[model samples]
Target: MDTATHFAMGFGLAGLAYLDPVVASTPALAGAVMIGTVIGSQAPDLDGLVRLRGTAAYVRNHRGVSHSVPALFLWTGAIFVLIQAIMPQAHWFHLLSWIFLAVCLHVFVDLFNSYGTKGLYPFRDKWVALNAIFIFDPFIFAAHLVGFLLWASGVDPGRSFLLIYIIIAGYYYWRVQVQKRMTELVRQRIGKTGTYTIIPTLSWTNWTFVAKTEHHWYVGELISGEVIILDTFTIKPENERIAAAKKSFKVQSFLAFTHHVHVETKERPFGYEVKWIDLRYRSRFQGKSHYMFVAVVYLDFDLTIRDSFVGWIHRGEDQLAKKLDSNRQLS
Candidate 1:
């Protein structure tokens, strides 16, 4: 989930704190629980501080260790101690309970989105992306907003959010069913032997998908139960130049972050340009296809790395090429 949504959920959990008799009776303890919940909700994302280092470092470690099993308990304990220090009169166990719930919910929700977390780290080093929910679902956010509004307007927050959560639970079930149907459509219409990755978009009825067969890559969208293939690329065999490009640290980090990757190599006037596209993300504009997430590496005639760029592409392909050209010249 995005930062805003996480913060909103923190408030929702604080509203839920109204259910506790101790918190409901004491204003100071209630304030302490609110602070504890908000901080606990964002504790795992402290890894965002890694952005100060560089994009490569951020991508490699963003959700890797920070959202792990041990981190959850560690964050809860640290947040509880901090909040308790500020408000000694607050009940220890009640503040700790709300903080722990906030931390656990933060990690649990991240697993449902496309950019999943390493929740099972150390025990199993793999990203657990259900791909059933978008990173920022408007419906989920609206529910939290409405619940908060009602709480602000003097509605009993405990009763209001309780009903909201039940509806949200049903919404999650429906989404899981929709995800299953999308997977079935791909298997029936495309090939069952291949691997299919379903990526949810912000729109409810639309989805993006990347299917890998034995010899080709299929990139498409699912709209209104229809599988609309936007583009296709062949899975070419790698050569020596291509092999050398993957040795760079930037390319290695990209490979570690994603699984559905496509690599292309082209000869340039100065050197060779090796492009890696994460097929899970594709953009279309004005009847053309654009790969949004990519890493471009420029190698000399001898395949020595000269320059590289590994990040998301906001501008069109032409601008991306110009940017790569600029980077190569500076190098």
Candidate 2:
């Protein structure tokens, strides 16, 4: 799940726990304590890399240690030890004192996807069945989707009201995978340049994409089935219709925090290839450890967000192959 969404989920769930005492009369600090219970929601399937590595190999495995209940316990114990060492003044009940509920919340969010997490791994070897959606999908972010909508509508949120927000966000992880596949297929056949990378169009269309091939990139309008090929290397000043990228203050801050901020303006055969670090951990769909907001840079074109990355249409990998076979001159 995206960090912003996670934060929202955490904040909302914590707020809801807080509301428990006030609304349901649970108890004081129950909500705040629930916040810690939610920790490790993303923990269960820490062994995801096993299956991800593929079958038929001793070195390859899924649901290994992280999927084990014992692992979770060990991790929690380690957490407690750290808490004791660092915050001896705090009581054990003080979550910041000796427990890790945030870890549970993390694992909960992880379980909502297709590749379910090992929620009770150490306790039970069964994977929690969450057939609701994929591991990550932008569609589920509909609440995050509706969030901006509600914001625009001037809807203000109160404490504990965050539960609705967390439920929606926890569900958003499933939707991200849906868009991820769509974007991947788009790149699989865009061109033979092999220089392309699927860029996320989160701001424009959640499922939208921009293909950055070696010398070119194409913005696709998946719905209209339109593909426009833009010359990435040949740009003249007269080509004033170039697009502009919207500055995301949050993403920018993340990059800046890691000292990965970069902006380049150089001439290209087409227009410009805005190369910089992809500190934005949007590549997790492609497979990576944690969503590392590390200091790194990657190339993005000016037309990405502007023209909506609508350059060329992919004929599909099979279609591209068939077209190539037909075009090969009979030697």
Candidate 3:
């Protein structure tokens, strides 16, 4: 989920806090909880600061460790302690409970999106992406906006937010059903799939799908009850050169962050270029050419990595050429 949605969710959680009699009765404690909720909601995303290091670092660690299980407890405790230190008059127990809920909510909702979290970190580093929701859902945002408007209009914030959450919960349940049906439809069409993923778009009926068989990757779109095959790629057997390229820092990090990856190796004039693409993000814009989130590694004839770029980049071939050319000029 986007930051705005997370912040709005925090705000709604604060409203739900009214259910607690202690929060309802104590004004100072209620104010502290509200403030804590808002901060806790976005604290997990503080890892966005990793972008300063580079796209590789950002991709590798953005939701990798910061959104993990241990991080969840750490963030909750840290936020509670910080808030408690500042507002000593506020009841400690209520404040801690609200802040902890806010932080947990932030991590929990992220699991539903296409770009998921490694929330189970120490236990398993595997990324858990439900692919049931878009990173930014307009409907979720609108609900929060409406709730804010109602609160601003002098409506009881707690009750209004509670009602909004009930509706949102129903919406999530419906989305899950829709996603299940979409997957079923796709599986029926593409029999004997090894890995199948249906990523939700902004529209309820429209979805993007990626399925892997033993031989090929099936990438397509399900729009208006139709499965439109966008493009397909043949799965290549891994070789020593490709294996060597995989050991590169960029490729290793990219692998850690994504699944259903399709690797393509091409021989160039100077070296070999290995492209690692995440099929889950495959898309075609305005009926133009298809694109997928990709990383590229340029290797010498001996299979030593020359240069690389990772993360959600476009035009893998063109970008690789430009990066190699730039490196050549610098050398």
* Highest-scoring model, lDDT: 1
- Which model, 1 or 3, shows the larger lDDT? 1
For each candidate, the alpha-carbon lDDT, in order, equals 0.87, 0.40, 0.83
- lDDT for model 1, please: 0.87
Model 1 C-alpha lDDT per residue in residues 106-218, reported as the tens digit of each score: 99889988888899998989888889999999999999999989998999987888788889889988998999899879777776479888889999899988888899888
Q: How well is each residue in 114-189 modelled by candidate 3, as lDDT tens digits? A: 8899888889868898888898999999999998899889888889888998999898899888888988888888
Ranking by lDDT: 1, 3, 2
Determine which window of 10 residues in candidate 1 has minimal summed lDDT.
322-331
For TM-score, the strongest prediction is 1
Please provide TM-scores, in order, for all candidate models, with all chains considered together. 0.95, 0.35, 0.94
Clashes of each: 0, 61, 0
Residue-level lDDT for 109 in candidate 1: 88
lDDT value, residue 308 of candidate 1 = 84
TM-score-superior candidate, 1 or 3: 1
Score candidate 3 by TM-score against the native: 0.94
* Model 2 accuracy (lDDT, Cα): 0.40
